[model samples]
Target: MLLKYIISHTRLNESSVKNTIKLLNEDCTVPFISRYRKEATGNLDEVQIGDIVKYKEQFEILEKRKIAILKALEEQNVLTQELKQKIESCIDLITLEDLYLPYKKKRKTKAETARKNGLEPLAKIIMSQKANDIESIAYKYINKEIKNVDDALEGARHIISEWINERTDIRNSLRNQLERHAQISTKVVKTKAKDEKAQKFRDYFDWSESLQRIPSHRLLAILRAEKEGFIRVKINIDDVRALERIDNRIIRSNNTCADQIELAISDAYKRLLFPSLSNEALSKAKEKADEAAITVFAKNLKQLLLGSPIGEKRVLAIDPGFKTGCKLVCLNAQGGLEHNETIYPHPPKNDSFAAIKKIASLAEAYKIEAIAIGNGTASRETEALVKKIQFKNNIQVFVVSEAGASIYSASKIARDEFPNYDVTVRGSVSIGRRLQDPLAELVKIDAKSIGVGQYQHDVDQNKLQKELDVVVENCVNAVGVNINTASIPLLSSVSGIGPKLAENIFNYRNKYGVFKSRKDIKKVPRLGDKAFEQGAAFLRIKDAKNPLDDSSVHPESYKVVEEMAKDEGVTLGELIGNEKILQKINLKKYETQTIGLLTLQDIIKELKKPGLDIRESAKVFSFNQNIKSITDLHTGQLLPGIVNNITAFGCFVDIGIKESGLIHVSNLSDEFVKDVNEHVHLHEQIIVKVLEVDVSRKRIQLKLHKK
Candidate 1:
C-alpha cells in the first residue's frame, strides 16, 4: 500500500507507523495516543502519528470498499478471479467505484425480465445487424410467450441490450471519460410558498457550466439551493460520445453483423447508458465535494496549527454575551488566570462606562501587556467601549476567536480552575488563555467545539471528530511544552502522557517539587519507561540538569549524540547548537537502519535549534472603534479578519462584525483549486473587502484581496 510505502520511506519511525495502524484499527482516539503512549512510540507526538493513522485508515477503507464491490459482482456471477484481483489492486476509490459501475444495484429493468422469456435469439438476430430481413426475425418470436411485434421487439432488445451494458470494464472506461467532459445545468423556477421563501432557488436561473470548473462552495450552494426548491439541477455529459469508442469496437469485432450490432449498441446506449453515466458523473461530483471539503478542512487545520502565539505576557480577556455582560479574566505569563469579573457594558447599557473604567484600571494595576477580546455577541460594542480608554503604551488589544469558549467555561476543568466563580468567568479565562496558548487551551475543550471546519456537524461525526482530534494532537506535539509551567490539560497532549499521567505529573509537582530536569520526569507516578521515551523529548526542562536534555533529543538516542559531541571535542549542548559542525556527521556511522537517514536528518536539524516551537510569532490585532456596525462597511475598504471557519467553498472570517463574511472559494486564490485549504485556513488573519452586503438577511459576501 502507498501508506505502508510512505511510512517506510519517511523519517517517521516504523514502530510509530505500526502502532498507529494498530491503534487506528482498535479505534483508539488520537488524544489517547498523544496523551498515553510515550516510550512505545518513541515519544512520537500526536500530529505525526495522526497523519500516519489517517492515511492508513483511508487506505484501509478504499481496500475494503473494493472487496465489497467485488463480492457483489461475484454474487451476480459477473466477477472472474482475474477481474477480482484487478479490482483489489485498485488504489483509489474513484477507480474502484468505476470498476463496480455495471454490477451496482438498480431498479428492475426490462432487460432482466426479457431474458426470462424465449425472445433472446430473435433479439440477437435484430442486434446482429446480419438480418437481411428484420420482419423475418420478428416473426419467429411473435407468439403468446414472446407476444406481438412491439412486445417481441421490446423483449429481444431488452435481453441483447442488457448483455451489452453488462460489460463492466467498458462502463468503467466511459464513466472516467464522461466525468471530465460533463457540464452541470441548473434553473430556478417559482414554487408555492410564502413570499420570497418559495423563490429561494430563483437565483440559479439559466445556469450552465463545466463540472470540472465548478468551485466547491458554489457547488454546495447550488445543491442547497435546489434542495430548498429554489432551483432544478441537472448534469449533462457526453456519455453517447464516450460510448462511441465501444460501439466502434462491437462493429469492428463482428464484421458481417457490424451494422445490426452497431444499431443495437446505439439503441442500448441511447436508452440506458447516457442517463446512467450522467447521473454517475453527478454522483462523482458529490464525492468530489466530500473530498474537497475534507481537503479544505485539512488546510484550515494546517493554518490553525501554524497560528502565532502571544509570548509570555499577562493578558486580560473578555467574553461578551447578551445577559452575561463581559466576563473578564486576567491570565499571568504562565496562563494561570489571576482574577475574574463580570461587568455589563451593554443591554443594561446604563453601566457601560463603569465596565470600561474597570477594564482600564485592571490593565494598569496588573501591568497587562495585552487585552484579549472574545469575538462573540456584544464583543464589537464592548471592544469599542474599551478602545475609548487610554491605556499605557505597549498594551495591545487582540480580538481573539472565542470558539468553544462556552464549552470550556462549562467544563469540569474550568470548574476546578474557578470553583468560586460563575461559568462566564471561566469562559473569559479560556478566551484569555487561548491567545496565550491555543493548543493548550483548546485541548481542554471538545475538538468539535473548536468550530474550524465546514459541515462538521453534518459529516460523519465519529470520523470527522477523530480526524480533527488527530490534527490537534499532531499540532500540539509538533511544538514541545514547558513541563514546569504547563497545565495538566496541556501535559495530557504530550506523547505517552495521558490524563492519568498528566494528573500524576502535576500531583508529583505539587508534592515533591517542580521538576528541574527532563530526567526527573520519570519519577512522576504512573509514568512508565515507555511513556518517558515518547514524552520526554517534547517536554522541555528549561535550566534543566543537562542543556541537551531540554532540547528535542530523545533519551534513547542520547548516547549517539554524546558520542558525536565527544568526537567533535565539545559538550553535547555546544555540539547540538553548532549547526555547521552537526551537519557533517556521517549517516553510516549512526550504523543502524532502524534509525534511517531520514531520522538522522531530523535529528541533525533539531540539534541545530533544539526545542524549536513550530508556531509563528504573534501579531497585534486591534478592532476598529469607528467601524462597529455592518452599515459602516465601505465597498472597497480593506479590513483584517481572523479565519473562524473553513468549508470546501471558502473561509469564514470574523472582521469584528456581528456575522462573519464569506470569501467564496473562487476568491480564495489566483491558482486553480484542487484543494481550497492550500490557500487559507482557520485562525489565520487575512485581508478582505466587502463585495456585497445584505442587511435584511444579515449576509455579507467578501473577496480575498486588499481592496
Candidate 2:
C-alpha cells in the first residue's frame, strides 16, 4: 500500500504512527490512539499525527487520479512505454495533469484543420532552420490549397503550434514557469448579474493578484466579491516569458526559421499553452486553498470536539439577550434538557433583583455545578448580576462562545429533538453542552457554522464539505464513543456508521434498553459483521463486563485474543490482569491476516490502559479572581490566564472572566518569537503580569517574560 510506503519514507518514527495506521485501518479513533498509545507512538502529539492522517487522504486522491489518467491514455491507443513510466513516477495531481495536457482531447480548431491540409511538414521544416530559403521552403508546399505567404505562414504557424502543444515535456516546463510568474486579478463587470438586488458588487469593478501568495481568507473574499456580482475576475502573468521558454528550448536551433519559430511558439502558447496552463494554475490554486481551509476547519473542529467533557453533571446554560430577557436551560449531566426558564437582570426587566433571586434559587435547588453563560448581548451585565446570586458550594461560572449555537438551535435537528422548546432555550442548551464537550456537541452542526476557517463559504462548498466530514469522522472516531448514551448525531459520525445506520441504532436503543456489552450491538437492526468490525474499535462501553469491549480491540479479534491468553497458560480473564505478558507474544505467528500481529499488539496495550475515558485530562487553572476585568487591573500586576487564541503577533488570554487580553510577542518573555505556534497553543493556561491597561480602548498589555 502507498500508505505503508509513505510510513517508511516519512520522519514519523514513533511506534504510535505505526500503531495509529494499523488502528485506523482496524477502526481505532485518533483520540484513542493519541491518548492510549503515548509509548507506542514515541509520544507524537495529536496535531502531528492528525497531519499525517490528512496527508494520507490527499495521497489517496492523487492515486485515484493517477489510475484514471493511466486508463484514459491506454484507451486512446497512444500510451507509450516511456509515457507510462513518467505517469507512474508522478506524485502529485498537478504534475500529472501537466504531463497529460497534450494527450487530452480538444475541440475542432484552426490548428486541427491546418494539420489536415498537410502543411505540418512545411511548418516543421521552417521551424527546423535546415532550409536555405524560407520562401522556397514555403513554396514547395504551395498549391491552390496552400495559397500565398499569409495563408502559408498562418498554416505553418498553426502546424508548429500544435507540434509544440503536443510535446509533453515542453508543456510541463512552461506550466511550471507560468505558475511561478502568474498573477490572478478580478474586476467588477458593473453589468448587473441577472439579479439587480445586489448592486454593491458593481462598484468593485476590477481586482487582481499573484496566484501563489494569496492568503486563504483573501482568496475566499475575492470569490465572494465575484459571487455578489461586484466584479469580473481574471489572472495576469508573464505569458510572453512562458512562450519564450518554449521558443528557446525547441525553436532556438533553426535560425533560418527563427523569426517564424518565435512567432509560431508565441501563437502556440497563446492559442494552446496559455489557455491550458492558466486553467490548470487557477484550478490548482483553488484546490490548495480548499485543502488549507479544510485543514484549518478540521483542526478547529477536532479542538472543539476533543474539548474537555464535564459528564453527567447538572448545568445551567444561558443565552444572553437584551429586551427579550435571558433564556435559560438546565441540563442534567447526560446533556438532556431537564427544565428551562427566562430572566432579564440586565436592563428593562420589571425587577432585576427578583430575576437574580429566582436564578439563585434554581441554582441552589437544581444543585448546578456550572452556569454556562453565553457571551452575547448584555452578557457582562448578566455576569455582574450572576455574581450577586448565592449558590451551593463552588458553582464554577463560565462564559461560553455561542458562535453557531443559535444556528444549531434553529436547525431541523434541534426542531426534531425539541419540538416544543423555543429557539432561545435550545440555544442555551447548546451553549451549556458545548462547554461540557465541544467536540460531541459541535459534531451535530456543520463545520462551516462553527466559524474557525478562512473563506469557507467562498471556496468549493462540495469539496470542503467532504473534507470536513472526513475530519469530523476521524476526530469522532479518534475519541471513542460512549455507547450507553451517545446521541444519534454523534453515533452516526463514527467511522463506519451512516445516517441510516445511525437512525437504526437510535431506534434499537429506544425499543430496547442500554447495551450491557459491546457484542450486544449485534442485536441492533441492520448492524452486520462488517459494520460491527469497523465501528467496534471506536465504541466504548465503560460498564461492559469485559474491559476489552471498552478498548480498540474489535470483537472479531477476541477469539484470537483468547487463543493468545491460552497459549500464555492463563485464562482470558487472567490475561486482562498481569498485562506485562502481552509483550511476550509476537503477533506475526498468529496466522490470521484478518487480525495482524501489529493489531494484536495494539489490543494487548489497550488492555492495560487506565480507564475507558481515552481523552485528554482536564487542566487546572486557578485564575487570580482579583483580575476579573481589565479596568480592575493595575500596572505590573501578575496573573494567570488561559491562552484562548494565537495570531502572528501574539497571544490572547482569558483572565478568568469577560474580555481576554493581548500579550504581544515583544513582551512574551523579552525574547525573540519566530512562530506563534512554537511559543503557545490553544487552551494552554499560563501566567502573565500586566504591563499596561488602556481601559479606554479596552486593551490590556501583559508580559510573559519569565525564566
Cα shift from native, residue 68, model 1 (Å): 5.6
User: Compared with the true structure, what per-residue lDDT tens digits does model 2 show for residues 1-707?
Assistant: 55554565466764556666776676654554554445555656666667667767777888888899899998999899998998888777767886887778879877777778788888877866877677767776777776876687788888788878878788778767767877878765545544465443433355566788886556666667766666666876776666667767876454657778788888877777778777877778877877776665655555656767665678888887779998888888888998898887766665688788887878877778888887767666677677777776688777676778878999998998899987888899999998777777888887788765556776788878876787787778877788778888899888667788888888887889888788788888888876776687788887578767777776767788788888999886677746688767777778464554456666777666623455564443456756556678888887877666654457677776566788887877556876555666556668788888887767788877441
lDDT of 1 by residue, 235-308 (tens): 77665676688776565444434544665677777777667776767766766775566556655765665577
RMSD of each: 6.0, 6.3
Residue 366 error for model 2, in Å? 2.0
lDDT of each: 0.73, 0.73
Off by over 4 Å in 2: 1-100, 116-118, 136-147, 178-244, 252-256, 282-286, 460-463, 542-609, 612-675, 683-707
TM for every model, in the order presented, reads 0.76, 0.77
For candidate 2, give the lDDT.
Answer: 0.73
Q: Provide the clashing-pair count of each candidate structure.
A: 12, 23
